[model samples]
Target chain A: MIANILDGIVLGLQFGLLAAGLTLVYGLGGVLNLAYGQMAVISAIVITLALSAGVPVLLAVALGLFVGGLAGLILDLTILRPVYRLRGEPRVLLSLLLTLGVSFIIDGFLNWRYPLETLSLRIPGEAVEILGVPMRRGSLIASAITLVTFAALFGFFRYTSLGRAVRSVIQDQEGARLVGIYPHRMLRLILVLSGVLAGLVAVTRSMVTPVDAQSGLSITVFALIVTVVGGLGNVAGALLAGIILGIVSVIAANLIGTYISLIILLAAAALTILIRPAGLLGVKE
Target chain B: MLKVKSLSAGYQGNDVVHQVDFEVGSGEAVMIIGSNGAGKTTLFRAMCGLLVPSSGQVFFEGTDISGAPAERIARLGLRFVAAERHLFPQMTVHENLLLGANPYRPDPKTMSLILDLFPRLAERRRQHAGTMSGGEQQMLAVGRALMSKPRLLVLDEPSTGLAPLLAQAAYEALGALRKQGLTVLVAEQQVPLAMSFSERGYVLENGYIKLQGTAQELAANPIVRRAYLGVT
Candidate 1:
């Protein structure tokens, strides 16, 4: 039971990071990047390719994260900014469709490039026992890394000028603009931040579970569920929701079947929608 | 410090402010007093570059700022306080004030000056803006604008929703800023209060400037008295 709980926490932290990225992008850009998972997949592929080419693991990981940030910047410069120029529901609708289209394009390209092969990061290390429960070293490291990243981000939002500008934009875009904050620049920075987060998740998760091109949709769906349950723009809430979902999924899978976990997650999402659409910590608009 | 010539602006195809012309000299306090739908808000929006005028020019300190982005215009030192207290309701009063100082880098002296100007805000600096009463929020919005240390400060309906005493206090704060040589342009519905502080007053009705003169001259005008002041 303890081991299962630990596993859930590990997975939950991963999910929380993805949801944080989703929340910021949606909050500022007013667009849900359904392609968010593909961005991760692309970073994972970059890291895998670099490792195969005999690059050191540390440099390969850095390169992969950079690939993610650059991809986010490119997408923002190309597609997302135009969609943002629109107002109201049409903007939201168009942004969704565009990201959906981009996701498909990425999937198609990756499948074409690396057909019939699954990929994973090979961070060679030995399993370690904690309180008589053996834990995979990679998973433990991933959890630690995730926690540190979240802590750093919390500080950034609280203390940095750019970070406060982001929060201000989240609070009121018009108010942000009035104070000489350019929404476009803030959007670019957020996309880059989100992309870097996706890269971290991709690198960490792929170390334990090999990923194929087809996995992006499922990952994004899980992220969407976690984000909706947490509160669309509430970062801390998303983290808590991720952990709760992770624990529940682990317990449910152990008692029933692996398929039951996904079902339970979907049900939880539906319950949130029906009962409290603003989410656990969502501010009512 | 500010000039508007033949300014025509509106929402959609309908022109709400038609061929309006005005000038505010440096360090001057001016008021545009008009009833609801008199296009005061629209005029302020145009001046701030929040809305692109269909035709006309807005010059601030001899620079044509008519079509500049609102953020760019603000960086150039003309600050606008919207009619609604547009505070970041989720953030603390300190955070809102910090953002007001965004165009210029945050400075301790400026923040201290703003807090001194409104002591109630200082007491509640850590409090979220949304939880504040309407009067407090208005003070916060104006205080946030002053954080930028603007050369020309434009306020839209600063007195519209405040209690009588709160409204008096707000104008008193504005009067203090005026004494500090900050040029102020107030668009208000309350004719008497606005005219009391302004050296010049413009009477706007249905998007046209009906009268412009020294505050005393317009305050004494027969039509101004009958229509606005409830004077027979």
Candidate 2:
């Protein structure tokens, strides 16, 4: 049970990071990026290709992360241009449809080109013992990276002026404008940041299990579940919900079975909605 | 410092403020007085670039700023504080104030001035803006706008939700800022408070400027007294 919980923590940290990216974009600009998972898959594929071309591991990962951010920037400069012209429900609907289309196109292209490509970052080390349970070095390293990323993210949002401007847009677009912060510029920046986060999740997840061309849908689904269970646009809520759901999924899989654990996770998310519709830490609208 | 020429604006295709011509010279305290739904808000919104004007031009410091986006206008040093005070509710008072100087570092001297102007804001610097009382929120709203050291501070119904005493107190703060030589253009429904604070005034009725004169002139005008001042 201790080992399972530890493993769940490892997974939960990734889940939290994934949801943070999705939530920020939705909160900042009402843009629901359905192609988010495809971004991660593309990053993973980029890293795999770079590695096969004999690039150093670190450089390959960096290249992947850059590509991820570039993907977001491209999205903003292209399809999201029309989406920004809209307001309220129409904006959300149009963004969803457009990003869904983008996702399908990306998924199809990846399947056709790299059908067997996968990313598996092997951290060569013996299993480390923690609390009398043996943990894989890759898992430990991945969790460390995730924790550090979260800390940096929190610090950026809390301490930096640029980060505050981003938060201001999320809180109130008009208020942000009154302060001379352009909503569109902030949205573009966040989309890029979200892409980098997606890439980071793909990299970390690959350290635990291989991430392949077909992993995009599952990634997006997991992110959506964590995002909803956390709150649509609340970062801290995402972290909390991610960990709780992570543990529930692991424990359920241990006690019942792996296939049923996904359903169990969905049930937990549903229960959270029924009980606190605003999410665990979401502000009541 | 600001000029509007034949400005007409409204929601959709309907013009709520029609042919509204007004100007505020440097260091002047100007007021646009009107009752609720009399197009005061619409006029201010159009001038500040929050709404696109159907036909007209707005000149700030002799440069045309008509139909510009709100953020661009703000960066040009004309900040608008809406009646609803669109503050970041989840953020602390300090964060909200800091954002008012966004894209630029918060100047220490200006920060000190604002805090001194509103001691209550200093006291609640760490408190979330949404949790503050209506009066304190009003102070924060004005203080936040002041952080940018704007050339012209355009305010819309600053006294909207405040108690009678608090409303007067808000004008008192604005009065103090005016004494500091800051240019101000305010829209107020509370005619007496505004009349006392502003040197020049314009009366907006329906969608047009009905009267423009000195405060004393408007205060003594029989029509103004009968319609707004509640004096027999």
Candidate 3:
């Protein structure tokens, strides 16, 4: 049970990080990026291709991150241009449809080209013992990377002027404008940041399990679940919800079965929605 | 410092403020006074680039700023404080003030000046803006705008939600700023408070400028006293 809980925590940290990227875009720009998972999968594929070409591991990962950021920048500059002209419900709907279309195109292209490609990073080491339970070095390292990223994100948002401007857009767009902070510019910046985060998640996840061309949909689904439970735009809420749902999924799989756990996770999210519609930490809009 | 030529603006295709013409010279405290529904808000919104004008141009410091986006206009040193305040509710008072100086570092001198102007804001430095009382929020709205060290401050209905005493206090702060040579253009429904604060005034009636004169002239005008001042 301790091992399952520990493993769940490891999984939850990734879930939180994934949700943070999705939530910020939605909150700041009202753009629901359905292609978010595709961004991650592409990054993983890039890393895989670079490794096959004999590039150093670190350089390959860096290249993957760059591509991921480029993907986000492209989305913002291209399809989202029309989406930004809209307001309120129409904006949300248009963004959803356009990004979904983009996601399909990416998924189809990747599946056709790299049908058998997958990213699986092998961290060579013995299982490290913690609290009398043996934990894989890969899991330990992934968790460490995720924690550091979260800390960096928190510090950036809390301490930096640029980070505050981003938050100001999310909080009150007109207020941000009154202060000379352009909402569109902030949205573009967040898209790039979110892309980098997507790449990081793919890299970290590959250490635990292989990330493949077909992984996009499931990744988006997991991110959506965590995002809803955490509150749409609230970062801290995402982290908390991610951990809770992670433990619930692991414990359910341990008790019942792996297939049943997915249903249990959905049920848990449904229950959370019924009780707190805005999400665990979301303020009523 | 500011000029409007035949400005007409409104929602959708309908013009709410029509052919409005006014100007404020450097360091002048100008007031646009009107009762409810007199199009004061619409005029200010159009001039500040929050609402696009259907016809006419707005010149700030001799440069045409009509149809410019609000952020761009703000960066050029004309800041608008809307009646709604539009503050970041989840952020602390300090964060709100910090953002008012965006794309530039918050000046220590400006920060100290604002805190001195609104002691209530200094007291609630760490409190979330949404949690503050209406009066405190008003101070914060003005304080946040002032943090930018704007060359001209445009405010819409600053006294909208405040109590009678608080309304007086809000104007008092503006009065103090004007004494410091800050250029201000304010839209006010509370005519008497505005009359005392502004040197020059324009009476806007149904989207048009009905009268333009110095404060004493408007205060003594029979129509102004009857319609706005509530004097028999």
Model 3's alpha-carbon lDDT is: 0.93
Deviation (Å) of A22 in candidate 2: 0.9
TM-scores vs. true structure, each candidate: 0.97, 0.99, 0.99
RMSD of each: 1.4, 0.9, 1.0
Which rank order by lDDT, best down to worst?
3, 2, 1
The DockQ figures for the candidates are 0.78, 0.92, 0.92
Per-residue alpha-carbon lDDT of candidate 1 for residues B71-140, written as tens digits (9 for 90 to 100): 8988888989998867899889999999999966788998999889999999999999999999999999
Write candidate 2's Cα lDDT for B64-112 as tens digits: 9999999999999999999999999999999999998876789989999
Give the true-structure RMSD of model 3: 1.0
After superposition, which runs of candidate 1 have C-alpha atoms over 4 Å from their true positions? A116-118, A122-126, A130-132
lDDT of 1 at A263: 97
Native-referenced DockQ of model 2:
0.92
**What is candidate 1's lDDT per residue for A59-147, written digit by digit as tens?**
98899899989989988989886797798789889989999999999999999996544557656777888867788888888888889
Query: Which lDDT tens digits does candidate 2 get at residues A174-239?
Result: 899888999999899999999999999899999999999999998988888898899887888889
- The lDDT per prediction is 0.88, 0.92, 0.93
Q: In model 2 chain B, which range of ten residues has the least summed lDDT? A: B41-50
lDDT of 3 by residue, A144-259 (tens): 99889888988999999999999999999988988899999999999999999999989999999999999999888898889889987788888999899888898988898999
Q: Considering only N, C-alpha and C atoms within 3 Å, which residue pairs clash in candidate 2? A: none
TM-score of 3: 0.99
